[model samples]
Target: MIKLPTISTYYGGKGSSGTYQKIINHVRPHDTLIIPFLGNCALTRRIQWPAQVIANDLDPYIIDQWRNAELGPRLDLYNLPALDFLATVLKRPNLGRVVIYCDPPYPLGSRKSQQLRYHFEMTDRDHEELLTAIRFLRVDCLVSTYPNERYAQQLSHWNRTEFQSQTRHGAATEWLFYNYPIPEVLHDTRFAGNNYREREYIKRKAARWVAKWALLPPHEQQHIMEQLIIVTPNVIVNQINN
Candidate 1:
């Protein structure tokens, strides 16, 4: 029988105690850390490392929150463009092993509408660019994402591993993609939500808007109004219709 570390024991309230411990166990003290889209740094603050740490995200609000932390001085927090951030990191003198922990946005099409704001709907080309940029780092990186077929296919090129675990509220199966092989252990799992009306409402509205937009002609687009207004004379014309 194969046994893995039980995470339930260190599931601290609100913050991360067990997950950080697991991360620390995986990474040595000297490894440089990079956490992308760190929301409040709930899991990151617990990482006990003697090396340098960099927390990056496209959201200025998130970066501001992280920067305001009492322990913010220890970690390097950057509020820059994602590609620019990668470029800056690449140019650093000491390009050692970097452990990147990314929790990118999972667009579920909610009323809040964070998709456009965060540009969460990443394509294969975007992931390929990211993979190429960070592949040279001399360390293992862990990325957490919701289970999706497109994402799985995109990451299939890497050595992939899956870990099935239940969150505090629900059961989730997470995949871990690594450059190297890791141990796989079997864990006995248990079973499992109803807001059907709300979901249907969103779906219907989205479909309606999509259909409306699809029917719109090229010249009838919103941008066309600006050009039309510019070309039209401001003077009033005599109305003559036959």
Candidate 2:
């Protein structure tokens, strides 16, 4: 497994926990992940490495912290308002296979009826605007938020799945709204399987295959790999066409 640098602690930061893997399962290694409302960038750090990650936040302090963290070349940090940053990204040419993951602050209504303050809070209108902005984008998008009638109405056409997330206060239900159909095969096989046990089983099976391959002579190994490279594309195309 690829090791990624850990993001520093920030107020209102979504730490490296909860249902982030569920969201990452939908991403491919080739996808350019855009985080418009980057807080701690919990999701960006945990996703498959060597993937392009563009993250922006309104707070310059957080952006500077990330700059000092040495997060490597794969991640580009931007200090701009979420929507403005997204607008800049949209103007760029040839941004291949983009996936925008929106984790804006929880709406006021969803904040357990208490006035919880953050450095930047997304008002009801701001949340609506964010959702509206991504609605027309050609790239795939996934939004993480609490369940509410406003989102239900706005994202009625979008696919949704819910999972329990631990909040500072208690457990809360978090929802993911996505625009694309779930691929039968995830781009990153590391995130496959329905549960941890199944995942471990697959991992062991993969290790066994690697062990077997290692025993092959160098020339035979090269031949097998070349054959796989030739056939893999056609198999992927057939899957897509089916």
Candidate 3:
């Protein structure tokens, strides 16, 4: 978990630092993650990254900030329109197990204020196009948005989960829509529970297991790990299918 320097903030950044755990609870493994709507990259920065990560934003200032961070050679940063970036990426070959996580500008129709605050604000039409593009993508996709009628109608078939979050204006319900079912194997197990209490309970339970395992003899530990390796895949497959 090498942490990169934090990027500067933007107006209406949709910084998910507060709610990222909730959103990440629904994530699963992928070879690469594409963030076409990278703002401050709050959620992206916090996640357990995959083999590769590509983030894009139309705003040059935001991309420049990321570039200045020297985010290392592994991260591919782009300053391109979201849809165009997606289209270009899709054309590339051998993209195995890609996941696109979009935190696009909140639709004006769903917001309290009619005034646009972002460097690039999205209209209802813009949201429609984005949602449509996501719908047709062959690989997995996850989107964060408010509970808007147009969004609901467009992504009606997609699976959705929500979390209560605090915004500058006050409390709000943030929805995460995914094309896949909730995975049996998570991308990161650090945020594994439904709520704060449950998460703490899981943390304690894992700690207890770790302590108990540490007390076991070397032979016993090896035997247990071997058995688990032999059994886990089938169990996971069964759980996912059901």
Candidate with maximal lDDT: 3
lDDT of each: 0.50, 0.74, 0.80
| Pairs of residues clashing in candidate 1 | none
138-242: candidate 1 lDDT, tens digit per residue? 556665554666556656655554544345545545554555444221010000001335545766777898798788897677666566556653411111100
Off by over 4 Å in 3: 1-9, 13-18, 226-231, 235-242
- Highest TM-score against the true fold, candidate: 3
TM-score of 2: 0.81
Candidate 1 segments exceeding 4 Å error: 1-25, 107-128, 135-138, 165-169, 183-242
Cα RMSD of all models vs. native, in order, equals 23.7, 4.0, 3.2
Tell me the tens digit of each residue's lDDT in model 3 across 1-242. 56564654464544544587877777777778889988876668777787778889998988887788876766888889899999988777766778899988888877767787887888777887888888866788989888888888888898999887767778788888999988777777788888778898999999999999999999999999778767896655543442
In candidate 3, list every pair of residues with a backbone clash.
none
Question: Which regions of candidate 2 deviate over 4 angstroms?
Answer: 1-18, 213-242
**Candidate 2 total steric clashes:** 0
74 Cα displacement, candidate 1 (Å): 2.9
